[model samples]
Target: MSRPQHFGWFLARGFGPHGWGHPYLDWNYRWTEPALYQESVRTLEQAGFDLLIIEDAPSLGSPATIDLRVRQAFGGPKHDPLLLAPYLFAATQHLGIVPTVNPAAYLPYTAARQFATLQHLSGHRLGLNVVTDTGSARHFGTAPPPDHDGAYDRAEEWLAGIKALWNSWPEGALIADPARGRYADGTLLGHVQHRGDYYGFDGPLNALPFTDGEPVIVSPGGSGRGLGFAGANSGVQLALAPLDRESISAYRAKIHAAAVEAGRAPDDIKILFAIQPVIVSSAEEADRVVAASRDPDDAAIAYIAEKQSSDLETDLTALDLDAPLDLSVFGGHVSQGSIARLVGKHDVTTTPLSTLLAAHARLGRISDRTGFVGTAGEFADLIEELGDWGNDGVLIWGDLHPVTVHRILDELVPILRRRGILRSDYVTGGLRANLQAF
Candidate 1:
């Protein structure tokens, strides 16, 4: 049997909503209302996308300072994605709304009740993207951000505790028997006592259980331990699609084995990779887009430094990007799992700081490096090949401009349908059901 591929629209940077006061959007919704996201959500459902993951971060850059952060509006000037989930749910019949949340930042009970409420209200269309990061933890004076592996450890306990709270309300706990003058089976439920290494959560979660099962859990695994954690817990695991088929095959096998080791069936988890397909009418246009022109100078260097500071959770602006960096200052401070990825294991110690910055500057141009640049049909073929390589689905990141969105909806979606890769219509059940269908 052929399992069709799933697609999700990753709505980060407020795709169309934070229009920067631009009048050309052709969208009538004000920034404060659901009107902006409703159209995008509607378009996604029409094109048979599976879910919409609303990416969020508490800080756009280093939380310690304000000038560069506010100046560039890096990821600032944002409206909460959680604020939009309800509106999105009201606007569409399908498509899961999974918002990113760091478990450590919120009291486990609050997170549990919030998602459970959303699941019930959205008809089980809610999913939660669990993220373990340090930037946001600073704001609330929570425990210091754990090192990469340590963060995952906290996450394991955090998720377990949250699930326990969700499970506090047993199945059929609400009796609603008017004849007996009873509203619920008091003995059957209320409150959970979960004591874990990282958290002590006591419930009866104030919210009732979702009508469907617990809201879907999503984890993005960027490192080895992260993958292991995702394998053990996530219903859907996200990966940025690799540049080659070998890496794709290797990633799938690794994550699949991790799931099996965690006592789950190899097929139990759906692995979706992030892909941004640059659709164009012809090959020449693709070339022009790919041949991006940029000159890296002092200003570019400063921006890169700020970005690094933000990512590494430290300050790098004072250091010289054109010279070798001292390994001692940041030696143990850097999170092994994430930093190793940023700069290679060997280069972290040996390479000059300038070279590292240059590499990342080039990497930021990856959009020019990957994806098919031809007509929509050609891009569809590329998608099939990518799916054949391994991922169960792709998380598409594209501009929300009318031309780009329309080309995808009009030109690309049809080809995907004709090839039998995209679903013709949404399944009758909720987001999890449709996701697991393939």
Candidate 2:
């Protein structure tokens, strides 16, 4: 028997071109318009997904890497996902919409006011996927971005400042007694004055108080400081890790311990691991997909290189495939985690560039139970196993296009629902209620 778990969709490409490189581009749906995203989100809501998290990075990167960012539309040309949330909210009744927000980008007062308005407008279904990426700080003309721990420190201060504004209005601040001509109790509102190392704000936010709850806080960070931030602030922790029992258990234990240390219950945070499973029709097709990727052709290698280039912000297409990669080619601004992922268990001094790139293109079979390529039944089995290990849920990652959304959820949702691993109906309330329903 399997227990019910939450499910969500991650718009991995942010608010950029949805079906740009895929065959689905021929579907003729304009990615710039709102109709495409609205249709796709409705599909997710019908499939019983709890939320949709949009990923965003506001920078096109340094001048040297502009070509790498937009050459194949891998990373650049993204519109503000925050501006797109209202359209998503209007299209669905239950699915929560979480757009990526950086503390460095928006000031606490401005963010609080904008986010508060949306929370009430969405019937309390709004969520914030807070990120601490400081790479874009130059775009804002702020001081130089801080180090890893310092970035989190700024984020902690940023969140505290936002919350202070949110709580400025006390429970009895609004009376709304029309018969007595009394609208509110002026004395009940808090006068929040905050001056921190990174930010300072005075607030008694000019927004109505939330009756259901504030917007749900979502975060994605795997570092110790990141996990601590999640435990202290996030309602949902967007997780990434191997799917094995021990790895899953240890990851959750760290989050639980962090929550306990922060004076919060372990259940306060939901850890949903990110997975982009390749769904196929038959076991034979799954085998073919896996086999075809085992030895990537030149075209496949070029495709992988383009994506890695965008992420690393360093062009890798010109590098010699047969030669070992020079780690020095990566700039100081490049993410260490991205480098680790690219060089997975391979000695950078000995492994050829072709071998490193090929590792990423290889796909394994979920039927034989190695990786995420498989039929719907095999995919559900993996989900059920995660639930059995006390996992909260999984976030399906991909482009936010109707074709891509249907491709993954069409068969998988029914299987999950039948096994009681996915919710058939959401409880009344907002995103927080949905997460708590299980």
Candidate 3:
């Protein structure tokens, strides 16, 4: 039997309307109340998912208009995950709540205190997904945005400062000895006298020291700089790549080697691929659903093109959808995140117009690309086959809809458990221990 695999929910909007319209309107999900998000987290806990990543960005995505972003709901206007995380942690005993934090957007002292307080309160069931916001120059309220490698350079310093602040409260600092009237050992307090290239800070975080450890650190490492950052800091690395076994295996090997270079054990960091699973009642249903999603028609292409423009930073709305494109127009200007991924498949420098538009439509419209489309039995078989790479686990894009989410908990997970690839129940520990258990 294969080892038990781990799972996480990769949510862009807290609880989303991933498709254009409200498919889960019957589920009574109003963005105003915490009830909907709470219910989703509870469902994940029931299915024994290791963590839930609250994916966020400071600004909304492209077409350079609010109408498009709002219409699509593609990574826009999310309730602050940090604010929502505490409520989730309170509700679930085992599920890890990881909120995306942009280091540049926050002061180190402020972030250190924020996460430490949550970690202490949640019994260390907290994890933080760190992102380097490369969308625009003004994301950090700076004159010009940091370039690709520059963003990571700042992240390195930012995280170092945060760790220093977290370390300020030394081990065993909370000595509540009533008999001796000693509240804490001041002598053991750690300090953060950090002055670096990107940020500077002094003094220690005052929050109660995290007794167990800092919350799990999560990072999406698809770029070279990102891989280095994840290797050095991320407890769990988020990966998105071409859906091929060989590519996935080579990617894991690179990350593992990065960790070794950083003076850490290869297994210390787990890589969880961003996957969208299509689990239906039977193989036939799966085929139809997948075909529609992968080979989207004109309407689907236009719908997705708006979102892709945001990622690629190239507006395709005015261009010919069915006609071939002039790729040279985007010679030097290209998007970095999801846009880069779609463009990678086509020859952006020389490809025709329609081909570029099609590629954009396919990736932009569809979120999860870890292609396992079938019933639970087939899904489990696919997972076991991929596990041969020794990649840690897969984070479900989950489609941000209740029906899809329910299928994962109800149908997909059961088969995984029966096949011995999913945990029947959680073992004892916080986020890190629970994650490393697999």
Off by over 4 Å in 3: 14-20, 61-63, 136-140, 290-296, 322-337, 359-370
How do the residues 164-239 of candidate 1 rate in per-residue lDDT, one tens digit apiece? 8887778788777889898777688765777777778677877776665777888886778888998898878877
> For residues 222-245, could you state the per-residue lDDT of candidate 2 as single tens digits?
889999999999999998887889
lDDT of 3 by residue, 1-438 (tens): 787778888985554344336555666566656666777788888888899998776666434654555655765656577887888888889999998888767888888888888998888999989888766345557556677788889888988888888888776788898998999888888756887887878977788866667899999857777888988998998888765678898888989988998999988998888877656677677666666666767777776677765445556677765565555545232535555565666666567555665554442212233456667666667677667667578888854455657876687777777777777687776888888886
lDDT (0 to 1) per candidate: 0.71, 0.92, 0.74
- Candidate 1 lands at a TM-score of 0.85
- Stretches > 4 Å off in candidate 1: 1-3, 14-32, 60-65, 179-181, 292-321, 324-372, 398-404
* Cα misplacement distance, residue 99 of candidate 1 (Å): 0.6
Residue 260's lDDT within candidate 3 is 90
How well does model 2 score by local distance difference test? Answer: 0.92
lDDT of 3 at 12: 55
Ranking by TM-score: 2, 3, 1
Q: How good is model 3 by TM-score?
A: 0.90
RMSD of each: 3.8, 1.1, 3.3
